[model samples]
Target: MQHLETMPRGLPKAVKKCLEKSRDSALLAVETYNKPAIKFKSGGYIVLMVISWTALFHAIFFRQKKKPFYKKNNRFEKKDGDYCYWELSTCVSKYFVADTNNPIRKNLEFFIPLRNMVEHKSIPEIDSDIFAECQAMLLNYDKIMLKEFGNKYCLRESLSFALQLYPSSKSLNNAIIANPSTKPIVDFIKAYRSGITTDIMNSGEYSFKAFLIQVANHQTKNTLPIQFVAYDKLDDTQKTNVNRVAALVKNKFVQVPVTNKDLLKPSVVVKKVQTALGNPKINKNGKEKDKFNMDTHTRCWKKYQVRPENGNENPELTKPEYCVYDQPNDTYLYTEDWSDYLIEEMAKEDEYNSLYE
Candidate 1:
């Protein structure tokens, strides 16, 4: 700083003055923002940095400027006041404020009378009836919207309700087609409710049940809830898994294959378990004359795969050859019991002795 001061002036006086002006302008930009008076004023006037206070006060507050807030509607009377009331009344009438058909535009002419009565010094006080109308108008709008849309969208499990209403109708929306084509339903319903797509299904973003209810009434005009088709068909264990999956997601209405139509086929379970198990000939290859032995196949099948209950087919484990027991001890035990391990070891010993002889 001392060196800068001591250095000979590098330019003529005019140039130095220009540099000083530039520096002063830059410093003033920051310094004024931190000034105490500008920060503390509580008047209605907002502080702005574009102009100096002396200029801003003269231009903004002293001038008493008011820009137009609404466009003049030609149908209304020839005054801004007439249009202002019309707009407010229109908003209220269309909302939960009144019956769906209340005459909002007609009421625009009356707000002037209402405002003038109590507010202006010479005007008479507003009647209690006039005051009550405005108050009631404000209260009913929220009640109306909530009741109208909120009640319509509850999701139903059975296609019976939706099938009655959708698909065949030409105007059906994509949301109503809650089939595999319209996405997994759970994800779409969630996005509709929370207005956010999320990985965490139940992260307090939106309630799944609430979302389905909305979709049933508003968004998914044609589709039924995913769960209703065959909930009764799920065994207790499968039902429990469905409940667990529902609890983890943002929306509980998953297209979980709970119905017999949706339940994973035995072949699907076999394929999945086969990858986890050594390729034991548990299920017979299609058209292979001999099916896999029952004791070995059932033992292997039960370890990794669950048997489908009731009307489901599991030909791999159910074939007659698949039921054979080499040594019958109990009626159920063939080659599958704990004793099979002991018995097999003894058989190996006998074979080894025969070869040695």
Candidate 2:
């Protein structure tokens, strides 16, 4: 990573300042996380990393000659006479506008709400549970920095593996059990994880999961003590070998049958959407009526093709994110995302009217 003092003189003034602040913030985040004395590792790390990411996005936008501030009435919004810059969420939206399901974006999104949840409270129990996403966030930050500003701005060299004692298998569970106040945070984490697709959950770009196996020291004294192998980059034979080794230490997981508690009926979805939209009323057949009803929901499902019509031969064909087929009941169930999508799309006058067309 390039030191701030060594930054190129030719770089734009605003971009240089943003980049310098970003790099410093990132370094501070890593320092805080790696410090053995710090008990609030996750909270401190997240707060600093959020600032780092926001500033990094600002630097990128500035490099492209674009302002990264909110505008209203052709004027930049100001706070205390200084221009208000975009937040991390806004930056992510603008940067990845074309791809909503990007794993890197998902990882960042996970932390945005999490940061808020932990702001006023200490929840160190979550550190181990969210390690994968936290690692991926830092890696993604450095990767983007390198891509945008070349090798000179990379953070790889400045960081080292955080030393740690091995944790007991039930440490995370025990921590949460001991702290009843952590239930809300735990629930939030689980709900967020449940909402995302399995593919995104497993994506290394979304969350970096790995096994650290202890092996005998190499013959060469100077050989590196640790190395990271990219599981996705490995050949099939190599993967099989790794899996065989992993099996010896893998924890046995008992499968539990899933319940349909999260799956909502069509009526429930309609009610949720209507309530979310302030229960707007419209004229239907010359009488005032709820604008978003069963018919509207039916039109939405048909228009989005989130699920097949009733009595279709392929009853299981449904979008997992928005809708799912309940085989035993032979009915389509909706997800919270479905209602949220409706609330957003229907909130628009044009989009709501298009349901009729």
TM-scores, all candidates, are 0.15, 0.71
Query: Residue pairs in steric clash, candidate 2?
Result: none
**Lowest lDDT 10-mer window, candidate 2?**
252-261
lDDT of 2 by residue, 148-192 (tens): 988878889888888878743444345569788887676556556
TM-score, prediction 1: 0.15
Q: In lDDT terms, how accurate is model 2?
A: 0.84
What is the C-alpha local distance difference test score of candidate 1? 0.28
